[model samples]
Target: MKKIEFYKYHGLGNDFLIIDLMKKRPAVPDYNKLAEKICNRSFGVGADGILVLTKSRRADCCIDLFNSDGSWAEKSGNGLRIVAAYFHSNYARKKKLAFEINDEIADAEIIKSGSKGFSIKVSLGKPDFETKRVPMKSNGKFHINAPIEIEKTKFPVTVLSVGNPHTVLFVDRFDFDWKELGKIIEHSKYFPHRTNVEFVNIVSRSKVVLNDWERGAGATGSSGTGAAAAVVAGVVNGYINRKVEVVFPAGSLYIDWSEKDDNIYLTGPVAFICKGEYLFDAE
Candidate 1:
């Protein structure tokens, strides 16, 4: 077994175990097994997921992200920022990181956030709300005010995709039992690939509070997709203006719902918790 060094970081409160896998495209043949081992809090190194950094001929560097379930995130806002700081503070001495995520090239910057955490802002492309493009069960590109059943509970949901799938539902309050409702909605047949579920409470015309039950990550801190979903739900329901503030377990983020483009932009803070390494083996 090879000793792979790593670091643990958090954006808002979404944490990850990042690794400097070093140059060249690794055959990751068993990345799923690696994710399960390192992300395990009991018998493993412990983390939300693992990030592999490698030299990218397509871009500056490649950040391969995984969920605790060993599933790929496709793109991660927090992961991007963490990498931004990693590249800026450390790799900056030699080169600037112009990385590629989701096949899109984006230049990143590392921001100062006092002692709390390091803030990184990324041009997270655009938020897609179309029902079909967002891959929801709909005839068009948007899934707003759609009816679906979850554990015998009927409700309307809005679909949003920030490189991943999300479903938003407005609730009167944030006092529901997640243990009872989380898994139900996450696995509901209404969402084919399962989904990240959000319960939102609009506090003002521009601000709202929310709770989420993420599919692969389960219930935890903030989710970039969940925040984007809130903006989509707000615009369709006319609860608030297009741009809004969403408060989740991972602090707060500014999300803008562009009426002209129908894309949502999410902005927030990230952090570098710590760094470490471990031995990894699939068999």
Candidate 2:
């Protein structure tokens, strides 16, 4: 296998492989095997997920992402920014393109430099609060301040789905074992699909500090969906006004969680780490 050009990027700390699959599809015999192989820092491409950039008819461009666990997702917020940077440098051609993502559409523009990273704004579709849509085993309205047990710790959580399943817990301060708890809650029985857990500390009406125990990836990760869920949870708890700023260890994400609209939007920066190529045929 030859060294295929690749870019390493991260949203907060959730890393990814931004591939330019624009011209022709790369030969991938087994996605599951490839995900485990390419995403490994020691043995593979080294990333939390793999994001492929392709042509789109409906939007600026398109992105298809896959988790290291071999799960293909509809969208990835952090990845959007990273992809935008790649498009600007290589694919953009100094012209904007409509970004079509996973059957959804969003506008991405070439960001002028000021910050270390460029930003991307993604339309997060409609925020669904129905328990069935959230995939929570509840009826009628969504679950807010709902009690869920993971291990011996109990935290009343808001069951919300942001294109993905999540359970948000509001806290006055941050504490408790995150490494142990995050993994435990991710596999908690209630979520069915297993969920991303957010323990939030309300900074103000419009700001929050979020620590996520993300599913599929792990503790040291950034979940754009988890941040959106925190905002939705904050609104339900009367802790947030409309918009939300979720502070992570790496940085923060600004989320628009307004009550007037049913959709949520997440704005963040993606950092380009490095570009590398891998020889896979030998493995």
Candidate 3:
């Protein structure tokens, strides 16, 4: 049996387990299997996903993330914040840090810190609305407020990519079964690589409430990228401004779609829960 050390953190209620392979490390056979086994809520440490930290040349460090279902993820807003918190707690007290994911660098800065944890601001890159980039199967140029038929029901959705594919739907309220609908939309044929679903309700010009259905993690309490996607969709539709507060079931995440830079910035809080070791049977 091999013991793997892990640190747990959460942005709002969306949690992740981070394994630092920068220093003392273990030779594992499969990271996919490790993620699947360790993220099990019943049998292992419960989390929405896992972040593996390794040494990097392009940035301060590198991160490879996997969902609870053992699927690879391109990027995560909350996950990046969690990693920033972890690094600040142990490594350096510097306010700024850079992280590389799949050769992409995301710059992060610790805006606030206390005994609880830290609030970090990260650049999630630009929001792309092109259908070819979003990879949505469509003949049109963009999928802004386009109706997609599912089970004979047409749903007006705005699809885009913020490091990952997202389908945004603006609704009046959440009185119906959005989860069931989200599950169906996540596996919809229009999205070839699958997609995250966001049901957003506008509160004011600068605020909105969101319920997220992630592609691999289902309905989490909060999603950083989902929040960014909601704001981007709102801006494209002229329903909201460039900056918005995204409220979730647990807490809120602030998003700023900079008109000058054309990049989306996500700001939120991350808290350290605990740290422990997982016993894995290498045999």
Candidate 4:
């Protein structure tokens, strides 16, 4: 009945379906329903989330992110980088770009480009350690290395908001059931808004291995904001250096917590998966 054009992209293995609403300007009454239908792995163009690029007065463009389960996300590091790469390649063709999300402006720089894809570095604003801002039901204290009980297991967690809420845990190894633990903590009562989860295994001061379970999207290969959050948590707890390399199952991402500006920078690569049109019924 109705055909909608889409672009598929991935950073590491965190994939998304990009829709240029600025260009198409499709009249979809319900974006959440559309996102759920399009991001269904078994029935639709499967992806971790859907990124909608639209016009913005404050910046060059605006990014609206929706998780696969149709939940709105405040921000995403990998999603920003991927959108930056797309804009750099198609529209702006500049080394630096800016986008607005959730009423905040984020800047990105194109470091290098090749036939494979583009290397993008994005500014993830600053980390917010306020308990209420993180929306955690605490005693109005920063949750740094705090113990949270999940299924009779006491896990030390660090909670913060990098545009979105996140909970980071440091583990000695990956022997434990991280997936089950992540799910439990994600829906835990402590976090009013479900939070993204990261399990970190420190290798050195400058490197660590990360496994992520996103808020709305379950377990993913890599998470851009998750990596940034993990590094920030590590630095705040004196577990890792300011500049750290976060290794995921798919690839590695570099996070630099600039002491001078106090802003977190995320650098990674984005690959163009494919471009296609989806045929669906118009409502």
Candidate 5:
């Protein structure tokens, strides 16, 4: 048996357990199993996912993100900011930092820091509307504001990729069972690789309310990438402005689809929770 130290953090209510491997590495048989075990709400330290940190050759550090269900994730907006906060507090005090995930690089900036928590802005490159890039199994080029039939019902959705796949649906209200609809869309065969679903209610040109159903994590309080996708879809659909405020059940996040740079920037707060050690078996 071996003991591994981990730090906990939350962006809004979407939490993550960070295991730093930059200083010392541990031998784990399977990271997917480890993520499933550690992210269990009843048996282990509960979190939406886990972020495994290591030294990076291209950027300042690297992250291997795993969903609670033992699925590997390509990118996460909140996870990246949480890592930035983790780096700022422990490793360096610099305002700017870079992280590598699956050979993709993302730049982060610490906007605010205090005793409570940290606010960070992350650039998630640009939003891709190409169906091939979004990885949607479709014959069309783009799936923007198009009716996609699922389970005998057709839904108007705008699909895009902000590092990962997302399907955005603009709704008039949340009076219905959006969760069930989100689940259906997430598991639908239209998206070969399961996609995140965002139910957005546009309040104004610059503000909106978002409910997220992550691909592997189910319904979450907040999602950085989810928020970015909603805003991008809104802008493309002529509903929202370039800069929009995404309000989730837990809190709010700011997203900017920069016209000049053509990058999606997500800004939110990361709160430090607690740190502890977990016992595990080594390979």
Candidate 6:
């Protein structure tokens, strides 16, 4: 039996099982299969996804993110904050840290840490609005407020990439059947790589409420990138300001799309759930 130790953490109810590959490296050849097995809610440890933290040659460490269904993700905002909290509590002990995900590098700063939980601010890279960069099948134009039909209902959406593809729609209220819409749009042919979907309702120029359906994780309580993408979309469409407070089902996150650098900064709270070891046979 292979025994792998893990820690569980959550940022505004978006939970992840973090495995330190630098500590006790597993011999599994396929990490996708491993992620599927370990992220199973009933058969294994329940989590929205798994984050593999490993040593990096270019930065302080590296983050390998996998969805519950074992799909590889390019980046995860909340996952990075959780990893920063972990490093701050265990190894780094510093407020600022840098992490590499694939070829991209991001920085995180721990604002506060205590026995209760941790507050972290992560600098997500610039938002991409190009059609090709978002990987959306388009006519080479930015997809702001573009109409897409689902089940005979037309919805105007703004598509962008915040290190990941997102489809943002401004809604009047949260009473609509967003889950069904999210399911259909997430797998739409327009998005070749699929997309995380967000329905936003603007409360003011500096506040909005969001409902998120993550690409591979279904309808999650909150999504860091989803919030960032929603705010960026709002700013582009003249609905909200550059800085806004995004309210999710479980909690709220502060997002700032800086005019100076154009980088999106996300600040939220992270909770330490628990730590344990999982014993399983290698396939």
Clashes of each: 7, 10, 0, 0, 0, 0
Error of 6 at 187 (Å): 0.5
Model 5: lDDT of residue 222: 98
Task: List the global CA lDDT of all models.
Answer: 0.72, 0.74, 0.94, 0.92, 0.93, 0.91
* Residue pairs with backbone atoms closer than 3 Å in model 6 (clashes): none
lDDT of 5 by residue, 221-281 (tens): 7999999999999998899899999999888999999999999999999999999999875
Please list the Cα RMSD from the true structure of every candidate, rounded to 1 decimal place. Answer: 2.8, 2.5, 1.0, 1.1, 1.1, 1.1
lDDT of 5 at 77: 97
Q: What is candidate 3's lDDT per residue for 19-46, written digit by digit as tens? A: 9999977988778888888989999898
Cα shift from native, residue 22, model 3 (Å) = 0.4
Error of 1 at 34 (Å): 0.7
Better of 2 and 4 by lDDT: 4
Of 2 and 3, the candidate ranking higher by TM-score: 3
lDDT string for model 4 (1-283, tens) is 5677889999999999998988778767766877888899999999999999999998989999999998999999999999998888789888999999999999999999889898899999999999899989988579999988887878889999999999999999999888988999999989989999999999999999999999999999899999999999999999889999999998899999999999999999999999998876645
Point out the worst 10-residue segment of candidate 3 by lDDT. 24-33
Candidate 1 lDDT, 133-242, residue by residue in tens: 65666566567777777767778887777777778888888676864576787777656676778888989989999787777778767766677777777877888887
Candidate 3 wrongly placed segments (more than 4 Å): none
Models 1 onward score TM values of 0.87, 0.89, 0.98, 0.98, 0.98, 0.97
lDDT of 2: 0.74
Better of 2 and 5 by lDDT: 5
Instruction: Write out the backbone clash pairs for model 2.
Output: 38-45, 59-98, 59-99, 60-97, 60-98, 60-99, 61-98, 61-99, 61-100, 87-92
Q: Write the per-residue lDDT of candidate 6 for residues 26-138, one digit (tens) a residue.
A: 87677787778888889998888999988999888999999988899998899999999998988979899999996899999999999999999999989999999898998
lDDT for 159 (candidate 3): 97
For lDDT, the strongest prediction is 3
Give candidate 5's TM-score. 0.98
Error of 6 at 180 (Å): 1.7
User: Can you write out model 2's per-residue Cα lDDT over 1-283, one digit (the tens) per residue?
Assistant: 6445678878889888877777867786655556667887787778888877777766656787777776776666666766777777665455344577767775555444344876766556666778887777765477788777666767788887777788887777766676677788778777677777788898889788888876667765577877888888888778787687889998888888655766777788767789877666635
